[model samples]
Target: MSKIKISNAVKKYGSNTVISGLNLDIRDGELFTLLGPSGCGKTTLLRMIAGFNSIEGGDFYFNERRINDIDPSRRNIGMVFQNYAIFPHMTVRQNVEFGLKNRKIPKSQVTAEAQRFLKLMQIDQYADRLPENLSGGQQQRVALARALAIRPDVLLMDEPLSNLDAKLRLEMRQAIRDIQKEVGITTVYVTHDQEEAMSISDTIAVMKDGVIQHLGTPKDIYQRPRNLFVATFIGRTNVLEGEYRDGKLRLDQGYLLQNGMWDKIGDQPLKVSVRPEEIVIADGETGLRGTVLDSIYLGLNTHYIIRLSGGEKIELIQESTMEELIPAGTAVNLMVKKEKINLFTGDGSRNLLRGEAS
Candidate 1:
């Protein structure tokens, strides 16, 4: 395992800069994920670390050794592309052995190492089958086996599960995490799927427009987002615009939020982000009043769309337990969980609840 460091790394095409000056440090044996939407520079950053793209500026280091000038072949990094990249003409065993063979290990040791990883990837039963005969998951496993056969210093994956069906993607993601842990390799994964990154990564960097917006553990990123974008991007949130004045938040609908609410906020107009599951709805005279606009029954939860008295719309998710669904046009009282609410200034740059003890 190697500690990868990138300082002020920059990538540009002609005069257009795709990756601005960025700095990051990935620890040894850590499963770090770069997560963002399309064209957000996640893949570009991964490619730079893989030595596939030239670094226009800044330093790239592996284990304290400068590797900016090192070739991709000499970097000893294992890359699993989105397409799996399995050789079609070879059997599974042959494909896995290809990397070891290219490195010119002893013929006896090559087969042993290849077989070890094949079994590790749990595709040993189909070792003799060709790629054409394998399913998508099997092909992905073969690709992983091949990448690990060489025992690389770092493993980089580019949305490796995006091609598989939903069930297969889940299965393979778990398998990938298991294999990575068993081998104890430092891995960098790139994906746009928030849930997938949260499920597998030791650390995640949420990027936008060639820069990192948030960096934290999955729980930190999800439960206490630092900014409005991170809160909305990582999960479902209802952002309400309100005015803060003299220890009270006056909603546009004329509701005065005073007691039993988080009011220790700056004296400014701000937006409140409440997760759908954290908002409570019930039959009560107290709490903010709203009219249910719509309700959809999902298998695990029932989602409701409610319009506040001030005409602002918000969503609430309740666990599916009761048989009768709360129909639209029903008047309901809403209360946001005090600890679960996140406050952001009007510009949406900072979370006001960060320093306060919940």
Candidate 2:
């Protein structure tokens, strides 16, 4: 296994820079994920680590060894592509054994290693089947088995589950997590799916335009996003306008909230990020008044769309109750979980909370 470290990484296409002076450290045996939208440089960064793309500047290391100029084949790394790139004419066993043989392992040892990984991936039953005869999930298993067969020091997967069905994606993600833990290999996973990154990673780096916006555990990124882009990207949130003055925040709908920003001098326009689950039906008249526009029952919770008196719409999630649903046009007062909601300046660039990162 290897602990990968990258510092001042730069990737440029002529005058256009994709990645600039990026630094990342992935712990040994940990599943670290690079997550972002398409064209955000997640895959570019992955290819750089794999040595497929030349590093324009900076350093790449695998446990004290600089690999910027090392040929990809000599990096001692295994890669799984988005498409199952297994050999079409090869049987499952043959595909898994191909890597072992290429490494010049003894034929006897190669066979033993192939069988071990086949059983470990639970694809031993399909060992004799050709690629065309296997299901997508099974084919993915074969690809995984082949990658792991060589006992690589680092494993890199780029959108490994994108082509699978939703159910298969869930199942395969769990399977990958289990196998990675069992093998204890340092892994770098790249994906654009927020939920997948949240469920599968030990640490997540939320990227934008080749820069990492936030780096932390899944819960930390979700609950305390560094800025407005991350707050809106990681999940659903309602952005509401308010004004901060004299330690009190006045919402557009006339609801006043007392805050602890005692050092402020003059009134400042505020942008607040309130997640659906953090807003609830107020118990009294002191909350923002709104009229429900719609409600949808979703078993455990009911989602409500309300139009505030100021004409802005916001969503709220409430626990389902045995009583009848709140019909549209009903007047309601809303309250937010002050500690859970995020507050930003009017431009939505930096968070107002002192400890929250930008």
TM-scores for all candidates: the values are: 0.96, 0.95
TM-score of 2: 0.95
List where candidate 2 sits over 4 angstroms from the true fold.
259-267, 354-358
Please list all clashing residue pairs in model 2, or write none if there are none: none
- In lDDT terms, which candidate is top? 2
Each prediction's number of clashing residue pairs: 1, 0
By summed lDDT, the worst window of 10 consecutive residues in model 2 runs over 258-267
Model 1, span 95-185: residue lDDT tens = 9999999998999999999999989999999999999999999999999999999999999999999999999999999998888899999
Models, CA RMSD each: 2.0, 1.9
**For candidate 2, what is the total of clashing residue pairs?**
0
lDDT of each: 0.90, 0.91
Lowest lDDT 10-mer window, candidate 1? Answer: 257-266
Where model 1 places Cα greater than 4 Å from the true spot, the runs are 256-264, 356-358
Q: Per-residue lDDT for 323 in model 2?
A: 94
The local lDDT score (0 to 100) that residue 249 gets in candidate 2 is 78
lDDT of 1: 0.90
